[model samples]
Target: MTLIPRGFTLIEMVIVLVIIGVLAVFAMPDLSVAAIRGQIKESGPLLDVAKQGVVQGYGALGKFPANNIEAGIPEPTKMVGKYVTRVDVKDGAVNITWGNSVNGSIKDKVLTLRPAYVDGQPAVPITWVCAAAPVPKGMVLTGVDATDMLAKYVPLECQARAATAP
Candidate 1:
């Protein structure tokens, strides 16, 4: 009795691999963009919370906390972990910077907020910075214009910086 081989042929395997490679090539860019967007989204609420804490601290102590580690800044004590590495009010604006300690690869993100002239008005436009890392591919970084991806999410305080020009 002759037994026939039951595995995929070499050509079939190569074709499958090529198909997968094509799919990955097509999907990688979108996946990376989505991941960046997701990271930004996840960071938003954390920033909001940190801003609220800063406002509260300002209200109580008559000033924003000296830094993230100072009392009253709400140092990510609960489920948020210690992602909030720094928080400080500088040059009439609050700056909140945070990052993951695990991988240490992603750039530390900064969110600057400036108090609006109108009470309860949204803090000026947000801005982002790559903090010791290169800007991700397909992502543009602008140190001035708010439309730039990195600059869009910067807090108002940082926006004020953009408003001023030498």
Candidate 2:
């Protein structure tokens, strides 16, 4: 009687690799999306920094910082951690610009934080309304605004502000 070979054949190995390759192809997009979500979550603290800068500036200078420079927020050309790009303060609103590191759809969009200072007095509990910057170029969007597109990602307080837009 002849001894039977038990090792997997080269053909079987190749087939298994191909299956794995196909599975990876299907899984890649989901992984990318999860990564983007993580990145978004990480941005919360960065945004808080911007908010703190504005609030402190208002408290000390008796008004909002004229621009990002006055607010002490550096304008970044590239992504840093969850903050994709620069943090701008203008007109009592702090705008955080997203860079290429963000997901394709939401990339380059701006998240604006408007601190409620009625009559130049800081509101108790420091109320802030989140807003969206104007849409950027190359996005073939119509009828809907940036706030609408980014609604899912925006914080709850900002969602109400976006919805009330005239």
Candidate 3:
């Protein structure tokens, strides 16, 4: 009787490993961008806080706040989180600057969240437009856009919004 091998040959195993290595090389950049994207999200709570201040200011003053003090939030430079170095309220927009132990790829990048509301309607709810995201029809976009991060590093929703713009 003849005996046959029951397992993969050493040459075949090496070839499989080489294929895996090549695939990983292509995936590394996307995976790194995903990690940096997560780091950007770590500042969401901070952004939300700033948003509240802007909305409240609009509610009480019948208009959006022009700066942090008017919005009742801390100064931009004074605000700090694990990965966020600053959060600025600019003309009713929240501008978050990433840094302070964050990944080097995202350091010093700014992400803007501008409030959108129906023109001439103070009671209408405010919708936030991220980065350079498109605003809903009939809604007015407030504040200057300050987003400077790479598109791949922004949130998926932010990208989706931009993609749907006219």
Candidate 4:
């Protein structure tokens, strides 16, 4: 057999190490961010429940619900989920507070679900919007937006600007 080595060169080994380091650096933030987003998504079902309560109240009263009680939802402190500590319905908006086994970066952060509908048209179906998302043209948004979390930790659809069917 020939005396030539079959192993990688020193320079090639160094290059591979550098590439791995670079990839790890880039992947760290995304991994952490994805973990945070997953924790936040655990509250989605609770938010939907609150939204339903709000819509029921609106349909029955011809106006938005004033609070959890008016919306027929459980008390804010009583509506708890795996990663959410409370779900509050105020002025027909569902505000979710993340906590209770959530990541430190997102604990206590709030996300709001606001209701939107065509102005003066009760027949039109109600639509939901993320915190601070612009209401569609000719739509009215009811309730106060209480989203207090950073955009990076939210789902892609819930980032700074959320889109709704117009």
Among all candidates shown, the one with the greatest TM-score: 3
Error of 2 at 34 (Å): 8.2
Instruction: List the global CA lDDT of all models.
Output: 0.45, 0.59, 0.86, 0.83
Q: Which lDDT tens digits does candidate 1 get at residues 1-166? A: 9999999999999999999999999997666555554554455566555555545544565543555544244443341434445545442244545565412323465544443222232242222332222333333332221122354343333334322111
TM-score of each: 0.43, 0.56, 0.92, 0.88
Question: What is the C-alpha local distance difference test score of candidate 1?
Answer: 0.45
Candidate 3 segments exceeding 4 Å error:
161-166
Worst 10 residues of 3 by lDDT: 157-166
Error of 4 at 118 (Å): 1.0
Q: Kindly list the per-residue Cα lDDT of model 2 for residues 9-84, writing each as its tens digit.
A: 9999999999999999999876765665566657877767666776677667776677666666665342255546
TM-score of structure candidate 4:
0.88
lDDT of 4 by residue, 23-136 (tens): 999999999999888877766677777888988899998899999998998999999988989988888888888899998888999988888888788888888888766776
Tell how far residue 137 is off in model 3, in angstroms: 1.0
lDDT of 4 at 119: 78
RMSD of each: 10.3, 9.1, 3.4, 2.7
Error of 4 at 51 (Å): 0.6
Ranking by TM-score: 3, 4, 2, 1
